[model samples]
Target: MTTDTQTQPSSDPRYPVGRFHKPQTIDAVAIETGLKTLEELPRKLRNAVADLNDAQLATPYREGGWTVRQTVHHVADSHMNAYIRMKLALTEDAPVIRTYEEALWAELSDGKNAPLEWSLQLLEALHSRWVMMLRSLDDKQWQRTFVHPEHGPVSLQTGLLMYDWHSRHHLAHITSLRQAKGW
Candidate 1:
């Protein structure tokens, strides 16, 4: 049986860094690497959109997928939720986290037209606080679990790895689009 951590057979544009291969196991080394990815995400993301203008940002990375702009804002929105979830998981007993309609959220005004700098700056601050919180977690804290209404229980260790993969995934979307369009 294919598990969540297994990489899929094809390289779809929709999943640029490939689907997140949820590791079959979790350890300090794995968490450390995830932490590195989380720490570097802000800088890498800033560089991804550094030279794009409004017209370019509005272009879709794929035929029917979100525009580069929406992706940026979505990252901000999604990560904000994740940060809150982490907080909840730490203080509460297996708290069930809220789910969002990301597609609908992408269609909202700010998500579609907000300045890239806004999301970029938000990511910088978000990741800063996020990384700080993550770095302080002890062994017991790392095993904290949160229930996703849809996906069921998720441990902080797995969440860290998934979000780390998420950062690289979206970065590839922006960078691949730039390469394809010769931007």
Candidate 2:
């Protein structure tokens, strides 16, 4: 089965890559592909927004949705949480991970108005560290689990794939808007 990045088109703009569905079993190739996706996300995202002006950046990707600026910042925010959660899972036994209201976080000042450069830089640095940690893990470590307050126990493998989908999902938001608006 394909990951969200490979899914067929959907009508929902909010889920351009399609929604993430945890794979029944994550094999070595799936893990490798996920790692590659994680590594490419910052570059892909940067290219997606590089040509936009302040007005374009401030334009919402969809009606009643986050502006392109907010989407860029949100990816950094969300991925940072994923990285920390992975660390917590690796270091503790079934650590109960904290969950935040992402919509609320997106509405915060930094998410709404921060320069895209700040978040872009954060994604580069964060993904570099995150990929380093992911590469260092052995089979046993990959199987480590973390409990989320909302989703119960989740394996490191699942988390990796989820974030891979997440990276594409938001990037698609920007690209699709660019296509629709001819930006």
TM-score of each: 0.94, 0.96
List where candidate 1 sits over 4 angstroms from the true fold.
1-10
Model 1, span 16-86: residue lDDT tens: 76777767777777788888888999899999888888899999999998999999999899899999999
Best by lDDT: 2
lDDT of 1 at 142: 93
- On TM-score, the candidate that comes out on top is 2
Tens-digit lDDT track of model 2 for 54-170: 999999998999999989988998999999999999988999988888889989999988899999999999999999999999999999999988889999988999898888889
Q: Tell me the lDDT of model 1 at 91.
A: 98
